[model samples]
Target: MKLLLTSGGIRNASIHKALLDLLGKPIEECAALCIPTAGYGHPMGSPEGAWRFVTGRRSICPMVELGWKSVGLLELTALPSIGAARWEPWVRGADALLVNGGDALYLAHWMRESGLAALLPSLEHTVWVGLSAGSMVMAPMVGEAFIETRPPITGEDRALGIVDFSIFPHLDHPGFDENTMACAEKWATEIGGLAYAIDDQTAIQVVDGEVQVISEGNWRCFAG
Candidate 1:
């Protein structure tokens, strides 16, 4: 699978280019699936938030609003009861999966329950375009600091571990006081592994087992 992990969605031309490169095609020619499950897991995520993302109404995170050939919603919570036979094909057929932001653990929990985590290794041709928590869910772990949703719903900060490093997204955003460089450094210290602190204009791309940073704003890497 091709990964374009971003702090925000394609906020600049470079990230958009990176996304196009991952898709190997234009946005207008590709089919996409909008996964808004992550939002439901956090206070930041609400029905209005999910609605904005699915309908392409968001201003900052422009996942669904990117003008794809076609866009469909793939809520992870619903996949469990529907059976794999009905939903697996939809995943296999999409060119890219546009995952939303909110809570990584909540998203990770659903990914496991919905069987999407196990199925991810098989989607070799697909592109995963993630926003904030959407991207964090791909990392090894988000650390306790990022764990907003807790307990029986999701007990750990650990995610899929598909990627070798952790991510501190939304760095230096005016809206989030805790998303500063100092906070990221503290988070990185807890992670004790390779991690990237990226602002909204930055992105971490992984393809063919190689990771690359693509940015138009600010970013830094902390090595273990």
Candidate 2:
């Protein structure tokens, strides 16, 4: 399986191009499965909010030009088994899994409850794409120092574990400071996994389980 962990959206020309190259298709020809805010459940969001977010009329514009089949597990409230089946097949048949940005803890919970965590690893054929919180949650620990909101973090810090190391997204971007980087490095040292401090414009792609750093900007990795 291939994993691409990115900062925000595919707005960066290099990031967008990398996604296209990895999927091995024209953007429109590929199907994308988005898992936004997985733990809190889709019912938590008012249908209107869910619609706007998925359609990308709000924060972090979604790359809809890349065929996005709305498999929003949270949005399907009061549904039957058939509904899950409907959602599953599109994702199962898709070329890639595109996890949208949201609260990292919530997204992780959703993955566990929605059975995506189990299913994803088994699907060796599909590419796993995570953006922002999506990328953050895939690591062993998401750097809470980088996230602005204080979501109710439960006792656990288990991320998707798609990558062996933990990552902090948007590091060194304009407003961020070296202090935050220090905090992240400290956290990684405590966790005993490598820490990748990534800039917003950068991307770390793992193909066949090997990670390749792809970006012009600089990033620092802490491992001990």
Q: Which stretches of candidate 1 lie above 4 Å from their native place?
A: 151-154
Candidate 1 has which clashing residue pairs, if any?
none
* Model 2 ranges with Cα > 4 A deviation: 38-52, 58-62, 65-86, 143-154, 176-179
Give lDDT tens digits, candidate 1, residues 1-224: 99999999999999999999989989999999999999998887789988999999997888888889999999999999999999999999999999999999889988999999999999998999999999999999998878988736437677999999999998999979999999999999999999999999999999978999999999999997
TM-score per candidate: 0.97, 0.77
Alpha-carbon RMSD, each predicted model: 1.1, 4.2
Q: Which pairs clash in model 2?
A: 38-110, 39-106, 39-110, 42-74
Model 2 agreement with the true structure over 1-224: per-residue lDDT tens digits:
67778875565778777787788877666666555553233333455655655665645544443455433333322223345666567667777776666566667766665666767776776777777677877787665453433435564666777788777777666665643677667766676768787776777888877888777666778874
In model 1, the Cα lDDT at residue 97 comes to 98
RMSD of 2: 4.2
What is the C-alpha local distance difference test score of candidate 1?
0.93
